[model samples]
Target chain A: MKIAHHAHKDIVIPNSTRHLVTVRQAVFDVIQESGFPEHEMLRIALAIDEALSNIMEHAFETENLKAELTINLSLDADEEKFEALILDSGKEFDPGEIESPDILTHVASGQKTGLGIFLMRQVMNEVKYTFVSGFRNELRMIKYAHDFKTKGATNAGTQDHYQNH
Target chain B: MPELKITTKIIDHDITLIRLVGFLDAHTFEELDVVINDLFEKNIHKIVADLSALEYISSAGAGVFIGALAAAQENSGNIILAAANENIHEVFDLLGLTQIFTMTDSVETAAKAFECNA
Candidate 1:
C-alpha cells in the first residue's frame, strides 16, 4: 500500500443531515490515505460529523431560517495531523457556551441530545470557532497523530480549546 | 435515504434483538427511534441491540438508546447493547454511556442479561 504524504480535499453539501454519511466517508478516506490507525481515523471522522451536525441543528435550525443553506467542508491530512474546516453562513453560535453535562444527570433527565459538542471536544485536539461579523462562521478542528498514539483511544490528556476571532 | 439498516428478531418471546448495519447518524436515527417507539406502544421493552455488523454510530444514534432507556426500565424491562465493534463502542464510551448501559460480547450474553435482571 502506498501512503500519500499529504492529502487535501474539499466538500460542499446542503445544510442537511442527509449528507452527513457522505461527508464522514470522505473524511475517513482521506485520513486512511494519510495512514492513521483505523481507530484514530474513526474518531477523527466522528469529530467532524459532530461538528457538522451541530451546525445544522443549532446554527441553522435555531433561527427558524428556511432558506437554502450550504456548508463548506475542507479536510487536510498529513503525517503530523488531520484538520477539518467547516464554514457556514448560519447564526453566530459558539460551542463554548454549553457546559459539559454530567452523564448520569443528562441520561436520567430523559434528554436525547446535547452531547455532540462534548464528543467533538473529546476527540479533537483543537476546536476553534471563528466568526466574522456579517460574513461566515468557521469551525476548525484538528487531531494530532501524536496525541492519539499517546492518549491510547481515550481523551485522557486532551485539552479543549475554543477561540472566537 | 440514510445508510442505516435495522432488523429485529424476537428472542425469548419478549426480547427484541435489533441488528444494525451501516452508518447511524443524524440522518437515520429517527428510524431506530420509530422502531423502539413501536415496541413500547406494544408494551415490549426488553431489547438487545446487536451491533456486531454496525459500522458507525454518532451522537444522534446514541441518543435513541438514551431516550428509550428510562421508558424500558420503568416498564420492568431493559436495553442491552451487544457486539459493538471498537469504533461503535468508542462512541458509547465517549458519551459515558458505558456506565449507564449494559454491554455484552454477544447476543447470547445480552439475552441472558435480561434474564439476570429478571
Candidate 2:
C-alpha cells in the first residue's frame, strides 16, 4: 500500500520546563490525528516527552537558556509510519556515552536517573540523533503502524482497545 | 503546559495513597518526587500510587519512583502501584519496574499488601 493519506505539523515551544505541558499536548494531538490506537499514541507521547525532557535538562542545562524546541510530526499512510523530528539549538552530546541502566542494580543503589534514553529506544521503532550543524541537533523517532495492527486487518480499520494489563 | 495533579490521603497510619492525574513527564515529575520525599522524611514508608487517572508517564516520572524505592524499603515500606493501565504497565515493563515494585489491580489490594508486610 502507498500513502493514501498524510499530514504534517510543526510546533515551536520555549525551551523551559513550563512549556513541556504545551509541547506534549501539541504532539499528542498530532499523533492522534494520524488515527493510531491509544496505546501507540501513549507510547509515542512518552517517547516525545522523554526526548524533550532530555533536551531541556541536558542540552539547555540552564533554567533560562533562551532556546526553543522545534518539533515536526509527519504521518504517512502509504508507508504506515508516524515520525517525529525534534530539532533543538543546544550543545551536542554523543548518545553513545549513555547506557541503559540495569534496573535491579540501579534501583538497589538508589540511582534515579538514566531511564530516558532506554525508554525512547523501547517506545519507538527507530530513534536517531544527529548534530545537523553547529548548535543544532535533530532527534528523529518513528513508529510503524503494523506494530499495533492485527494480522489481515484493513488499513482503514482503527484499533480501539488497548492491551490492558 | 503539561499538568499533574497529585492528591494524597493517609491510610493505615503511615500508608500514603496518592492519586495522580494528568501527565507525569520530566516537567511534572518533581512534584511527585517532592511529595514522596516529604512522606519519607515523616517516616511514612508505605506509599500506594493510584495511577488510573494518570494519562501519561516518561522516564522522569518512572525515575522518581525508582529513586525513592530504596529509601522506602529501608524503613520497611515500599511504593505500591495500583490500577495502572496497559500504557503505564508497558513503560514500567520496559524498565523492568514490574519486577522491582509491587503492582496490584486495585488500591485495596495494594493497601492490603502493606498490612501483610507490616
Candidate 3:
C-alpha cells in the first residue's frame, strides 16, 4: 500500500531533560503511517534523538534551560513516505556534520560514541536539517516503505494493510 | 499529568541504572542522554538501562542507546540494555542492536553480568 493511508501527529514539549519521549511518539506515528518498516521508524527516531539530546546536554548549560520544543509528523499521500520535523529554540548544533562513530567495530570489540547520525542515514531515505531564527534548529527525515519490503498477509497487530517480508 | 517518569540510580558499583518508566520518544529522550552522560563523565564504567517500565521506545530512543554506547566506549565504559518487551525487543533486534548491547531479562542479571566481566 502507498502512503495514501498516511496520518500525522504534532506536539510541543517543554525544553526540560524530562520530556524527550513525548516527542519521539510523535515521530513514531509519522513513520508508522508512512507504511515503512520498523527499521525506518528507528532511523527517523535517531535523528530526533541526536537533535533533542544535544539540546538537553548543551543548550541548557545550567538547569534553567527550560524552553519549548515542537515536533510535527506528516505523511505523503502519493509517495508512500513518512516525515517528521522537530523544531527547538535551543543553541545551534549541526547534526549533519557531527562525525558518527563506527558502531560495528566498537560494539564488536566492546567499545562504543559517534554512530547516532550514521544509523539515522541508514534507515531514512531523506534527512534534512536547518537552523531558523539562529536559535531554532529544525530536523526532519523521510521513510519509504520500499526499503524494508514486506509481503504476505500483514496480520501483525496495528499494520493490517502492510504485509510481512 | 502523570505522563512518563524516569528514575536513575547506581546499582552494584560502577553500573548506573537508568529506569525509564514511560514512553521513549523525542520529548523524554534527551533527559536520558544527559543524565547517563553525566554519570559517564564521572567514570561510571558499566550502565544498565532497565526498560521494564518502558511501554514504548521509538527509533530515536534506540539511537540514544547507540550514541550512549559510543560515548561510554570513549570513556572506557559500556551500556547494556535489560528487560525489554516484545515490541521494544523487536526494535532492538531489527536494528541489530540486540547483538551490539547485551540484552537480558532483568537488571539484576545485567548487573551480575557486568560484575562478572569486570
Error of 1 at B5 (Å): 1.6
Q: What local lDDT does model 3 show for residue A27? A: 64
lDDT by residue for model 3 (B1-118), tens:
5445778887876678888887766555667777776786687857888989888765556767776776676766678889998768866764567777888999999888877877
Task: Sort the candidates on lDDT, descending order.
Answer: 1, 2, 3
List the lowest-lDDT window of 10 residues for candidate 1 chain A: A150-159
Clash tally, candidates in order:
0, 5, 25
Q: Model 2, A57-139: lDDT tens per residue?
A: 88765555445444343333223677787777777854535776777898898887888777777666666667755657777
Can you give the TM-score per candidate against the true fold? Answer: 0.92, 0.84, 0.54
The model with the greater TM-score, 1 or 3, is 1
Model 3 Cα lDDT, one tens digit per residue, A88-162: 666665665655455576555543234445555554555667776555666665555664433332222111111
Runs of candidate 2 exceeding 4 Å displacement: A1-4, A35-38, A67-79, A147-165
Q: Number of the top candidate by DockQ?
A: 1
Best by TM-score: 1
Q: What DockQ class does candidate 3 belong to?
A: incorrect
lDDT of each: 0.86, 0.74, 0.62
Q: Specify the poorest-scoring 10-residue window by lDDT in model 1 chain B.
A: B1-10
- Worst ten-residue run, lDDT, model 2 chain B? B1-10
List all candidate RMSDs to the true structure: 2.8, 7.2, 8.9
**Candidate 1: docking tier:** high
Per-candidate DockQ values are 0.82, 0.75, 0.19
